[model samples]
Target: MSKTEVNIIDPSILEDLCNNVTDGKPVNFELPNHGILHIDKLLPFICVYRYSELDFYFARVIKTQASYIIVDDNTDISHLLEGIRLIMSAKFETFLVLECWPISSEDYTTFEIFCPAGKAPSTVKALEKGFKSLNETYPNIAVEVNDTHARYPDQLEPLLNVEESKKTGTLVIGLGIPTLYKNSKTNELYALFFREFYSVFSETIKRAIHEFIRVQTTDDFENYLMFGKTNIDEITLTSDAELAEISEGMSFLLRTTPVNSNEEWTNFKKNEFKKTPEFKYRLISLDSEIEKRKLYNIPIDKVDDPTIAFILRGKRLEIEKQLTMLEERGTKNFRFVGESLYGVIKKNVLEEAKHILAVYPKREERKSKERFNCHEFAAHAQKELDYYNTKFPNLDLTLEIRNDVAGIMVSKSKLLINNEINLDANRCDALIQHEVGTHILTYCNGKRQPLQQMYEGFEGYDQLQEGLAVIAEYLVGGLTVNRLRLLAGRVIAVESMVNGATFIRTFNLLRKEYGFSDRISYYISMRVYRGGGLTKDAVYLAGLIDLMAYLKAGGNLENLYTGKFNITHIELIEELLYRKVLKQPELPRFLERESVKERFKKLRNGIDITELVN
Candidate 1:
C-alpha cells in the first residue's frame, strides 16, 4: 500500500505503523516520495538509508528479514524512527539501528563501519568482522571499522542522540558506502557490476545483522542464513513463470535424440559392423538467439531476495548454454558446449564404469512367457498415477503411447511410451518404478511447489533425476545385472565418444571387449553419438555412484525427492526449506512399501552401487 505524494510522513500514518509494530503485523508502505518502509517482521533491527538521486540502487541491494526505512532527507524520518524504537525496544527489550549514508572517499575501501566511542566494544567487533567477510568473496573491496565518538556520520544529522541510545537500549552503527556500482563519468548505473555486487553484498549485510543480533540481543541464532528473506515477491514469481514458459517451449532431449535410431541400427548391422551410421535430430522449435534474448531480459535484477536472485540468474546462464549447445548441434562446438552444460566424463567415473563392465560380464535378459504390450504397461502406469492422485488430487499426470519416442521417457508431467515397445514381465515392474515412481513422481511433487523452476527442473537436474530413477528400480527389486551392464556400457560409450573414437570403433569395443551383443552395442552407440557426442548418458552410472555415497554419508533420500535438482543443490534446498520459502515436499508413494522401506534402510546404513548389481 502507498500514500499520495506528500512533503512529509503524516502523523496518522506513523500512528498506524506504530500500532502494527506493537501488534506484530507485517508493515509495508510507500512514503511521499519514492521512499518505502518495509518490515518483514518485528525484528530487533532496521537498515536505514536516506534516499539520494545518485545512489538509487543502494536501497535495492539491502536484503534482509529485518525491517528498513528508505526515505529522502527532505522527509522527516526522525519521528518515524523514534516511534519504531519505542515500540521495538519495548517489545524485544533491545533494538539495533543500522543507518547507512554515502561517503565521498576515493580510497580503496568499499564499506566503513562507524561506531560511537566508549560504546559496546563486542558489538562493534562483531559488525566489523561481518563486513570483513566480504573480502573473501571480493578481495579488493576493503572494509574498515572506525570509532566516530558521535552516533551519526559527518554527512547526516543524528537520528538518535547518544543518551537516547543508552536509555532505549539501542545501538546505532553507521555504514559509509562508496556507491561503486555507478559510473563516475556518465553517472549511469553499471548494471552488471551492480547485479554482482547485490548478490554478494546483500548476503554480507545479513551476516553483519546476524553478528549484531548475537552479540547485543538475547536471541540465540544458529546461522546467518536464517536471517534471509522468507517472503518471495510478485516480481520473482512473475519472472519464474516467464522463464518456465520459455523453457517449456523447447525440449532439450527430444531435439538432441536421434530420430532415426531404428534405421541407423538396421544400416549398421547390414554393413557387418564396418561402417558408422548417420544420425538425424528433431526440428528446432524456437530460435536460439531469440530465446536467449528473452531469458536475459527477464529482469532477474529486480528480485531483491538474494537467494532467489542467485538461483534465477544461475538458471538463466544454464539456459543460455543449453540454447548455444542446441544451436551448435552436429558441430565440434556442440561437444564443448555439452561438456560445459552436462560436464565431461570424469576419470574416476570412467574407471569405475570400466571396472563394473570388466567384473560383471554381459548376461542375457531373462526371457519371460508373458511380455506386456504397450497397452498393458500404460494401464499399470495409470494405476500408479491413480494411487498418487488419491493422496494428492492435483496430481493429474498423463501416459501417452507415441511412435516417435523410443522406449519410455518422462517429459514434464507426461510419460511418453513408444508404440512398438514390448516390456518383459520380469522387468515391467522395475520400469514402472523408474518412470512412474521416480521421474513422474518428482515432476508432480515439483508442481506442488510455489517456484515454477522446481517443476521445470533445476540446472543439471538430469543427473540426480536419473540416479533416483535407477535407485527406484533397485528398491523395487528390478535392478537386473543386464540393466547394470547397460548403464556401465553407456558410460564407456560416452567416454569413448568424448575421447575422439569413431562410432564403429566404440561399437566394436563394446561388442568385443565388454561382451555386449551387436544390437546392444548399436543401441548404446546411437545414444552416446546422437546430436554430436552427447555426454548425458554417462550420468546414469556416475549419479548412482555419487548418490550411494551421499546416502552412505546419511543424506536423506526424501530430500532428493523434493524436486528435480542436482546433488549439489541439496544444501541450498535445505536452506530454502528452513526459511519456509519452499514447502516440505511430499515423498513418493513407493516409499510406503515394506520392501522399499527395507531397501532404504540398507541404503542408509551402507550400500554401494556395485552391491545393487543383482
Candidate 2:
C-alpha cells in the first residue's frame, strides 16, 4: 500500500512526503482491518502537531460508500492510518480512504459522527444535546462541541456490515446509536443501548457508564435510523474490449433459448383460466438449445473483470433457465422464469401501485380509433417510417407488418407491426416515437460502439427499453390516461399472479375494480399469466419508476439513449465514454427540434404519473 492509504501523520515524515511526492497523485496505505485507502491528494485541508514526534492530517470526506473512500489530500502518511482506526472503531471491518484533511493543540478533542446526509443535522444536534445535558449535570466533565464537518467516504460496506453484525449483539463505538438488539439467545426482542466514547479524558467514560445502564427496548431501535448511511455493494469497473467479443459469441444462445412467444399460449391460458386452473402445455423440447448453451458456456471463472464476469454469468443463467422452462411448462415454467427475472414483487412496490390505482381514473378514448385494417395500418405506419428516414438518412431501418409482433423493433434494424391488431390512430404518433425514435435510435447509437451488447442489450434490458419507449409517449403528448392506467394495472396484475392469484381473478380485479374494458383486462391479465407466469409486464411501470428517478437524479437521458442498458450501468457507461471505451450517442437531428426539446424539459423537470394525463 502507498503512504496515503493510512490516516496517521507523523510530523517527522510530513515534510519528507511533501517534498518527495507531487500533489494530486494517489497514495496508498494498508489498514489493520485488511482494507486499503487511496488518497488522491493530500489536499492541504488541515494539520495538527504535538511534540516533535506526533502529528495529524484531517481529510474531508468527498465520496463515501460502505467499504471504500476516495479522499483528496495535499499530503499525509500516518494520518490515513489513524483514519482507518477511526473508521473500523465505528465497527467496520475494512475500508479504503481515498483523500485527506485536520487540527490543533491546547488539549482539544475531536468527536466525529458519521451518518447519512439526511440524518447528519439531527444526529449532530442530538449528540451535542446529549453531551450538553451531561455537561450541565457534571461540570467537571464538560467539553464544548467545537467543530463538525460533513464528509463523503467511498467505503460504506463495512459500516453497513456493522448494522448486520448488530443482529447478534455487538457494541459498536464512535457510531452514536442506542441499539435495541433483539436477543436471539434468549428468544426475545431485547434492546441493548450502549453509548461508547473513546475520548482522551475520563468524562466520556462517565457518560458511557451512565448510558450503559439504560436498558433500551425494541421501540428505541427505530429511532436510531439517523445514525448511519444506507450502503450498497460497490460497482466494480473495467475497460476490457475483450468483453465485446465474449458477449458477442454468447449472444447466439439467447436466440435459440427463446421464451414462449406463441399466441396460442396466451389464448389457451386466457380461455382455461376461466376456472381454477392447473394448466399444462407441450413445447418443442429445448434439447438443442440446452446442448448449445452448455457448449457456449460463459468462462466466468476466467473473466478478469469481476463486473463483466458477473453480468455474463447472469445472462448465461437466464438463458439456461429459459431453455429449461421450455422442456417443463406450467408451474415449472413459471418457477424458472420468475426465478430468472426476479419477478417476485416486493411489498413496497406492490403497495405503491395499489395507491396509484386508487386515484388513477380511466379516460374516454381519444377521437382517433383503430379504423385502419392490416394493409392500411401498414401503409400508415410506413408514413411514420418515412418521417424517420428524413431525420436518420443512414439509419437503414425497415418496417414490415406481421401477425406475430405488435410494433416490435427486431434485430435493431427492423420494426414489425402486428397485422392482426387494428391500429389506434391517436397512438400511431406515440408508437412511432416509441418504436422509431427511442428504440431504433438507441439501437443505431449502440451500433457505433465496439460492444454489440449495447445494441442487442443485456439481460433485463426490456425494463429500460420499454420505459424509455413509454416515456416517449408522454413526451409527444400522446400518453393517454387509459394508457397510463394500463401500465399501472399491469403492476397490480403482476403482483396478484406472484401472490398465487389466477388469471381470471386478476382479470376481474382489473375489470371490476379498476374499470378496465373486458378485452383490455383480459389481455393485461393474459400478459401476466402467460408462459407459466411471466413477470415481464411489471417492467413497464417499474421501468418508468426507475427512469423517472434517474432523470430526477441528474442522469443524462443521452446515456440511456445510447443502447440497450440497465439503470445500474449508468456510471460504468459514462466511465466507458470518459475512457473512450464507448462512443457518444449519434442521435438524429430531430431530437433538437423545439417541440422535442420542450418535451425533454418536461421529462427532466419531473412528472407525477397520476396527474400527468390530466
Candidate 3:
C-alpha cells in the first residue's frame, strides 16, 4: 500500500481495542511480517508487544485495548505523533508494552533510540542508522539520543524491567500496550503481534519501534489518526502551528493532573474525624464528669474554653470521687455512732472535751495588729467580726487588719486585709459583712461537715470560689471598674508571658501603651511572669468572664455556691436536688448575714481590699 493509503488510527482507539480483545483469553502470537504480541488475562489482562520499524511504519493497525503497551521501533516517531500516541495509549491502560524493532538501513538513518527490554546492542545499532537518516532529512531539528542504560550503570536494571519502566526511562515506558488500548479487538491482534515479534526477532524489533516513536511528533499526524477523534474544524487542521499548539496543550494537560480543591480536602479531613470512635467518648466523659462534681460540692477550675473545661474535668475526677466517698462514708459513720449506746456516751464525753478546749478562746494565728495610723478602721472591723461571730457562734471567725492582701477567705485563723489600703468608715463596714459574713460563714459551714475535705478544696474549687466571691462582691455592689480592669490586665499579662515576651516587655507595654500606672503595670507583669512563669494571673480574668457568662445565662446564685466545675455535673446535681438525690449544703459562716441588704451593703462598699486576699 502507498504511504498515503496507510491509515494510522488515533491513540484513543487503543482503549477500544483493549476492551474488545481478550474477550477473556490468554493469546500469544507473532507476526514475522509485523512483530510480536502477547496477551495474558491477569485482572485487567496485561499485554506485551514489539514491532519492527518497517511493520510499525507500514502496518495499518496500531491501537489496542490490553492493559499495557510496549512499543519497540528504531525510528523517532514520537515527535511525528507529538508523543500523544504513547501517552494517550498508556493513560487508560495499566501498562505499556515495548520492544526494540528497526527499519532497513538502506531506507533511512536518522532516529536514535534506546532499548529498555534488554536489547541494547540492537537498539544502539538501529538508533545510529536512524539518527543519520534524520540528520539528512531534518538537519535543522536538533536531536541527541544517548543510551542511558550504558551511560548510567545504576539505571541499567531498572530500565530493562517493566516494573521499573515508569521511574527509569527518560520517558517512562509502560508495559502491555494493548491493555491501554481503547479497542479490545485491536488489542488481540496487537497482543499477538507483540508476543510473536518478541518471541521471534525479540531484540531487533524491540529496538526499532522504540526509535521510531522517539522521533515522530504527533503534531504532524492527522487528529483522527493520532487520537481516534476527528476535528470538525478544518481551520484548526489547516496550519502546522495550530496542530503543534494543540499537541503541546494535550501533552501539558496529561502531565499535570488537577487536584481536589481546599474545601473538598477539608471535608475529607472532617469526615475522617467523624469516623473516629474516640470522638463520641470524649463528649460523654466530659458531660459525666461535670455532673458528678456538681453533686459533691467540688468546683471546676475557672477555664475560658469549654474544651479546656472538658480536659480539666478528666484530670479532677479522681480527687472528686475520693471526696464524694469520704462524704458518704463519714456521714454514715457519724449517724451510726450517734445512734449507738456507747456512741451517745462517748459523744457526751467528747462534747465535754470540746467545751474545755473552747473555754479560753483560741488566739488568732495570723499576724497581730498594733496601733497603726488607721486604728479607728481596724477597731471597727474587729468589733463587727466579734458581733457576727457571736450572732453565728458555729462560725470560727477572727478579724485582723494588717499588711495582709485584699479579698478575704476563712483561712484557718483570720479575716485579713492590708492595713496600707485606706480602710475608711464605709470600707471597713463593707469588709465586715462581705468577708466576715460570707466567707467565714461558708468556711464554718463546710467545717461542720463530717469530711474535713469539704472545708478544704477540690480540683475545680477555684472556679466556684472565685465565681461566688465575685458574685458576692457584685451583690454587695463592691465590684468596681478598677477591679474589672485589674482582672483584664491579668489576662493580658498572662497571655503575653505565655507567648514568650519578657516581664520588662509586658510591663513597658502595659505602662506606656495601655497607660497603666507603674505600680499597676509592675504588679500585673509580676503576677504572670513571677517564679518561672506563673500562669495564675490568667485565672482571674478567665474566672470573671466565665462567671459573667454563667450568670447572664440565668444560672442561680445559690446553685453557684453549691459548687462543681462540670456543667453536666451541675445539671445532674440540680436534677438530683429536684428529686432530692442530694441536699444543699448550708450557707457557711462567711455567707450568712442577718439581712440580704446588710450583706449586700458590706460587699458593695467593702474595703479597697487588695485583690490578693481572694
| Candidate 1 residue pairs that clash | none
Of 1 and 2, the candidate ranking higher by TM-score: 1
Cα lDDT of candidate 2 equals: 0.51
Global lDDT of each model?
Answer: 0.78, 0.51, 0.38
User: What clash count does candidate 3 reach?
Assistant: 151
Candidate ranking under lDDT, highest first, comes to: 1, 2, 3
Model 2 segments beyond 4 Å from truth?
A: 1-296, 305-307, 383-396, 406-411, 588-590
Cα-based TM-score, every candidate: 0.89, 0.55, 0.34
lDDT of 3 by residue, 1-614 (tens): 43223323344533433553425333333323344333333221222334433334222222222222333332222332223233344433322233322333332323334334543444345534433333332333222354343321221223233344444233332221112111233422333333332222222232343443434323232211121111111221222222222222222111211122223324434664222111000111123244343433333222211222233344344343432322332133322321221112223323322232233123212232332335565577677567656645766567565543423334533666545554323334445555554555545544543223334433344445554555565554455444445555665665566566766688776666655666566656644443234444445444544555565566655654443333334553343344222346545343454554454444444433222122
Which of 1 and 3 is the better model by lDDT?
A: 1
Candidate 3 wrong stretches, greater than 4 Å: 1-377, 387-392, 401-413, 423-434, 562-569, 572-614
**CA shift at 109, candidate 2, in angstroms?**
30
Candidate 2 per-residue lDDT over residues 277-390, each given as its tens digit:
333333443364644455255344443222344455555555455555544445546555565565566565566577677776554565765466667656665776676666
